[model samples]
Target: MGESVAWVAVDWGTSNVRAWGVSADGGIVASARSEAGMARLTPEAYPAALDLLLTDMAIPAGAPLEVLICGMAGARQGWREAPYLEVPAELGGLALSAVEPLGTRPGLSARIQPGVCHKGVGSEDVMRGEETQLLGLSRLLPGFSGLAVLPGTHCKWAELDGRRLTRFGSAMTGEVFEALAQHTVLRHSLAGDVVESEREAGFDDGVEAALARPERLLSSLFRVRTGALLSGKSPSWCRGFLSGLLIGTEIAGFRNWGGDEEVPLIGSTALCALYGRGLAAIGRKSRIVDATDCTLAGLRAARELL
Candidate 1:
């Protein structure tokens, strides 16, 4: 059996759901993951899906379990919508205004934390899961103040003034890469994954190309095919080049948001490492934070508010 639970923490996203059983002092007791994410379930199906996740956990029967959740589960189309908290707002207040859905399990007291939104002059963006990571950022770097980036399907760049999330922006880097690689003519050149040994060289070339002429991105992508067909470039190299080109452009675009030569990147090791390399390309460095640890810490931090 797992360690006796104090509360449960969940990060439910579009494609997967991860839950952790936590001790009172913020230690993890148990953890589980499932493919039953928001995209696969209706509003009425969330509790059952969540129940299936918890079926094997070690929790006392008939005792209330405080389940704190973050991510797409709180989106407008998820189980129940938790309206976003506007930016320039305090991250600590996330749990205070959390929404509790009616008809959850008899012994489950579930609260879904709201996402953050930035409605500034010409910049409008919203984030769900990343806000929790930002909340956990406080514990990782106390009194931290600078730029923080989370790379994923839609990469986010957020600025923190001490503990408050000031302003943020999103880049559709991963999504765009998927579209270009799978649905467009660029597919021919990107048919295979980048070989580990070849990635660095191809990626560096793409970064340099994009940095030199960011405006010519559309035309440059065409070269991926032409280079493969004419110059006989390999599919692996072409894939790496395309990835680097997209990510490099994203970094170049967001560098002015005060990267300050060092940024905090929190996400999967693979993605964060890629972003770290991209940051290095632009003469900036980054610190990586494991997404799971941040989510647990953020959930614990939020629970304290109750």
Candidate 2:
């Protein structure tokens, strides 16, 4: 057998699958991806899709694949079912049982990291794969203890106590936004692109409107469509207005839940900016970090245990 030269790291989500070939020191050597996301696969089809990717990449047949995966790939419908680790647990200490691929080729082995569950006052939330990034962030910013916001289909507001994820709350913000923008009556009242100036103005207005009466969020949201139809408000501006309203509602909810005084937002640049803008309008402070970096760092951290 030839000497091992690469490691495989995967970030498998609902709609897409991303794989990276990394050097022993963690530099990405090459990468390949496919549409074989959890959303599009059946339990019986996952192993074949994974094998195709690895084989196409020419990953050595017996190099001890050294796989570390995260995201919905570990969920009930993905490769294998991994349980959730409850809160107040050391991120690095969590583990998942070894997962052996069916119809395995020579020398292929894998492991899937489990998700996390946090139970707090009046709230219970869960996350898969994100915990690794949080662990990576904690490692990068040692002694960092504050709120970390990860925005996606299900946005997570995690309370970090050192390298441990103590508690967190989940909001179906992105999914809700997508559904309202495309599948509902609200779609007819919004424009394609939202401008920066309008986003800022709308965001401020939204923060004020939401904070004035948090319970009236859904009713206030309908006003976007009503105002556009009845008063001839520009659809583009109304789109931005709707964006602001949703963000504003999130900010208000977080504020009510406490912990905004010293929170740092972590996600893609665009998402971080939007969240930061909305929070700033509410007179709260926030810092943004690159989501990709954290994911890579987290993948590397997970490999260490192997």
Question: What TM-score do all the candidates reach, one by one?
Answer: 0.95, 0.90
CA-only RMSD, every prediction: 1.6, 2.6
lDDT on C-alpha atoms for all candidate structures = 0.85, 0.75
Best by TM-score: 1
- Candidate 2 lDDT over residue span 221-240, tens digit each: 88888878898766666777
**Predicted structure 2: lDDT:** 0.75
Question: How many times do residue backbones clash in model 1?
Answer: 0
Which lDDT tens digits does candidate 1 get at residues 81-184?
Answer: 99999989788888987899766778889999999998776878899988888888877778888898999999999898766999889999999999998999
